[model samples]
Target: MSPTIEAISAMPNGEKPTYLLVMLHGWGANYQDFVPFAKMLNFPGFGYFFPNAPFEHFQVPGGRAWYALEENEFTGLATSRKLLLNWLTSLEASTGVPLDRTVMAGFSQGGAMTLDVGLTLPLAAICSFSGYLHYQPEFQDNKTFPPTMIIHGQQDPVVPIEAAKKAQDELTKIGVSVQYQEFMMGHEVQDPAIALFKQFIQDNLNFN
Candidate 1:
């Protein structure tokens, strides 16, 4: 059976999409949470897809998460990875955007999911903001990986800046080219981070 996904999309200049940017939202947030940010990063000749998580948040009404926060995060991550991959495949089929021209990105838990699934796929680039690697042994092997960038706030009380550092080290150990940046903010993607992300996209992915 095909997976059902609900998302918000924005096309560059209202023209046919040449590339895809998949943005995932953090826990306790809905798909639309990232729509504005996606638009800020929207470059010409690229399309954006902001997909809602499959499960509803336990506490926040109208909020969603890729998986339950109360459960083992690794288990949840594994399950979310499968569901996201399936949805991505169906989306590609429907949109006619090849997987190679796609970039995956997210913030916080969404950022964590980006690392979880994006690294495993044949995507052009990956970006993480306030995200962590979630540290799996299997993902730490030498291979040609998609170019990746991670941005985190140094004062982030929720995820901590160390998570991004660890991710950078592990990705480097695995021979993945990675760029790491830190901001002075707390648990947020600030303007500077977005600027860096925009540059990361232009450097690593092709939109024109």
Candidate 2:
């Protein structure tokens, strides 16, 4: 059985949802942290689900993480990916939203999860902000990958810009359509990235 996960969600205009936008929060943060960010996304006719990672109770009180970075990074990634997959499977069954219509996005470690988990799944699109790619043999053969956007800050101290660039390069090499953008700031989201993000979603996520 999959581990129990908690999430916060919002629908456009308080009506039924047509599309799924799953946004993962950074490490040491909780689900409620992204509620305002979701509002800023402003995707019409889409329901947003901000799932708190199972590994909460860390760093700050009530902060969560997808995996333990201090331990074996590879093993942690694999374990967290499994949890994300199971949660997504359950979500599809309960909400009737196909994975193909879902957009997986994240920030920091959550962005890394977006790249790790989203690449393997048949989602509509994947957005990675300050994320990196971990090369796996299985990923080399994926043929049905979705369009992706990688946004990173040039001065990111946590996850370097090179890591995000590596992700972009790797995705492009596999024939997956990828867009990369770099801002002049640090490790957090800004207005320029948000505008580009909105445009990317508008162009890619076709709800028809």
Candidate 3:
């Protein structure tokens, strides 16, 4: 089955957005988890969309998961990728936001998905926090690599720091432009990450 997506848009009254930021959440979390972060960024005049994962998590109540994880491997990554691609197409069709003006951001598992999916799809930029590269083979064959930013905590237990390095190395090897930063926190997006995110969007998107 295809993943279900829910979008939360914030556009100031009388303002039409030239760019859109799509937020994806980590495993066992839904779109609502990103509400606080979205409001905190407060990117005035930009459209924000937070999409819920399709599947219900095994243990978490009312929680959704993009795909199942087995050990370090996301078991259904391929399926999730197809679902997200279709979701992106649907969002564009419904909102009329061009793909070139769309950016993707996520945390942890969601971050991994953003990197994996964003690289293959045409996008303006991608920001990942506390996420790593999964399904490297898929990325190796992909031709389009959007401007990418990856931020991770040095002490992240859920996704190791080394994973972030490996992702950076792989993307670099494949000639994907990447800006990576390490923070002092763990498995969470901090203020520094937010600052980077804002700058990344401003640099890549014509939102001013």
Task: Tell me the whole-model lDDT of each prediction, alpha carbons only.
Answer: 0.82, 0.81, 0.82
Query: What TM-score does candidate 2 reach?
Result: 0.90
Error of 3 at 93 (Å): 2.1
lDDT of 1: 0.82
Error of model 2, residue 29, in angstroms: 1.1
Residue 65: error of model 2 in Å?
1.1
What are the per-residue Cα lDDT tens digits for candidate 3 across 1-208?
4455665666656477766788899988888888786578777766778888877887899887877874466666777788888888776776678888899988888998998888877899998899888766344554768899999999998999999999899888887899999999999988888987888888887554
Cα misplacement distance, residue 195 of candidate 3 (Å): 0.7
Q: How close is candidate 3 to the true structure, as a TM-score?
A: 0.90
lDDT for each residue of candidate 2 in 38-80, tens digit (9 for 90 to 100): 6797777788999988775446788887887656654456667
Cα lDDT tens digits, model 1, 12-98, are: 677877788999998899898888865687587788999988777889999888777667753355567788988877767777788
Model 2 residue 200 distance off true place after TM-score fit, in angstroms? 0.5
Cα TM-score per model: 0.90, 0.90, 0.90
